[model samples]
Target: MKNIKIILGLVFLTISSIGFISCEGDDSGPATVDGPPVINRVTLAINDSTTTVGLRENMYRIYGENLATTKEIYFNDTKSYFNPTLVTNTTILVSIPKETPYFDASDELKVVTSEGVAVIDFPIEQPAPEIDSFSPVAAGAGEIVTIVGSIFEGLESVRFGETEAVIVSSTSTEIQVEVPEGIVQSYIFVETLGGVTQSEQAFGFKFVIYDDALKEGWWVGGWDGSEDFENTEQVKRGDFSIKRIYNGGYSGFQIGNGGAPLPISDYSAVKVSIYGEQNVGNLRFSINALNEQELGVILQVEEGQWNDFEISLDDPALIGENELEVFSQIVIQELSGNSNVIIYIDDLGLI
Candidate 1:
């Protein structure tokens, strides 16, 4: 009887030892044995050693153990997005949530698994700024421009082309700044603690208009060849201006020095200011010699407000010797056949 009892005890001990061995050998066995997930390090997805704080809406990796079974992740209680297929037992790949609603980063990263939740102290950052649009899309230096976008909470710098601008005010959605000097037709750039962002569209430079030039050495004559227009104090910009009275039909005017041509070589475009009590349709202006080589743009002048017309001199064929003074004639034509139209013109010059 004693011998039989000893044999049974040995068998029971053998079974227990085999069970322990099996549990140790199988890595996918039970969650209790694996404890909880541990986050060793957080790094940019592109570089493992670059430990810069993660930016919102950007990708990053969390290296540690038992991350493959992670069910949820949070950056300071702000839930982040991750892919289960991308998670491995040793590392987890995730994208910081873009709409985190926080201006700054959080203090800790939380990871939850079926076994339990684990947290490691780390930083998650705010998203970079995004631009929707800006007002006065074209302006000269020292002019104030409004920039509309998201995440303008903390602005480090605003640049026009390569030149930095003077920031007047900033908010979550809008930024008001002075146009920087030496700015060309270049995109705007904004930077913050999160990162830098650039505008896809460029801001154009407004040409400097000479009001005095219009008062002297400039006359208007076209097919109608009438002198009904007069220089008036009602100016859109500077103190001097011209007012024209239209009495129906396709009428036009030629601007020159005593019926002679003027040179315009150093300028990029012609800027015109117009105001009328009624809408003017199909209005066009052209430079001398380039009329057939380059066509001007159509203008739809709204009533009761000042409107600007920018005609580009982009045609290389239009360039002439001593362009600043050689422009033979600048003619503005109204093809809409409107009757008794009163138009106010101001600030006509090279830009």
Candidate 2:
């Protein structure tokens, strides 16, 4: 009886050991996850590190549970493409496509998975408007001014410096607004749902010498037969630009005022737009006494493209020996011994 009882005890101990081992090793893998994915957070990589911003065409990491079976992703209802290789059970790597619309978007990032769909708040923005060029850069108050650029959709405001003007019309690539007083000589600004854009070029000039026509109190020397005060062929700013054909090297023109001297303190630079037909020698731009075309600052000229020269008032060559408040003369002469060239000048002014 004692031997039989010992054997029974040993068998019972062996059975308990096997049960313990089976309980500890029962995990096959992370058990087949069931139910919808739970989005914990979303993150982005910037500078090869981690940051967070929903920029178009930027890669992002979606952190959640049971996300390995992601099937589709939508940025504000615009379906986006993703790579399956970058997906995992707890995270997904995806990129927001550029074609996704942001203007008037729902701002919801929706992810569709095999288990279920998960929607999260993802803020996006439209691209800022780009100002390529604006027509009638110089216009009077109440005049219709047109702005040309891209991504002008959902415009918010159009300011000609400080005062917001009335938008006459708006399009994705263009906008027309009425010019306001006191802003005709300041930089134009545009705003949209995304952000604001300031024009690289000012709207209108402060004091004009020649636009469609020469302003009052301004005159041209019209030196020799080389100056065509009105040339319609390659007008840069307005209906006309002073076109000059250099007879040879060192030939140029001059502009002066009889009674209207510009206030030197009110301006910071002398802006002149020039379009060159060929590589001409440097232009010596000078401000001196009436008819003085001898002393000035030298500026390089480019061929086949328009160059805008804003000779600042700080340049010693620009203000040498000349009265500041009585800035009336402007002379442009080519450097010594330069070849013959043709050039068009427009928007000669003080700003």
Query: Which candidate tops TM-score?
Result: 1
Residue lDDT tens for model 1, 18-105: 9999977654544342768888888888766657466667788888887667899998688887888777777788888866555554
Model 2 RMSD vs true structure: 16.5
Instruction: Give the local distance difference test score of model 1.
Output: 0.70
Q: Which one is best on lDDT?
A: 2
Q: What are the TM-scores, per candidate, against the unseen true structure?
A: 0.49, 0.48
Model 2 TM-score relative to the real fold: 0.48
List where candidate 2 sits over 4 angstroms from the true fold: 1-33, 47-53, 183-185, 205-351
* Residue 206 of model 1, lDDT score: 42
> Across residues 113-231, which tens digit of lDDT does each residue of candidate 2 receive?
88899998786768788899998766556779899998898899999878999999999999999987544267889999778999998777767778867677776774432777788
Pairs with backbone N, CA or C atoms under 3 Å apart (clashes), candidate 2: none
- Candidate 1, 89: how far from true, in Å? 4.9
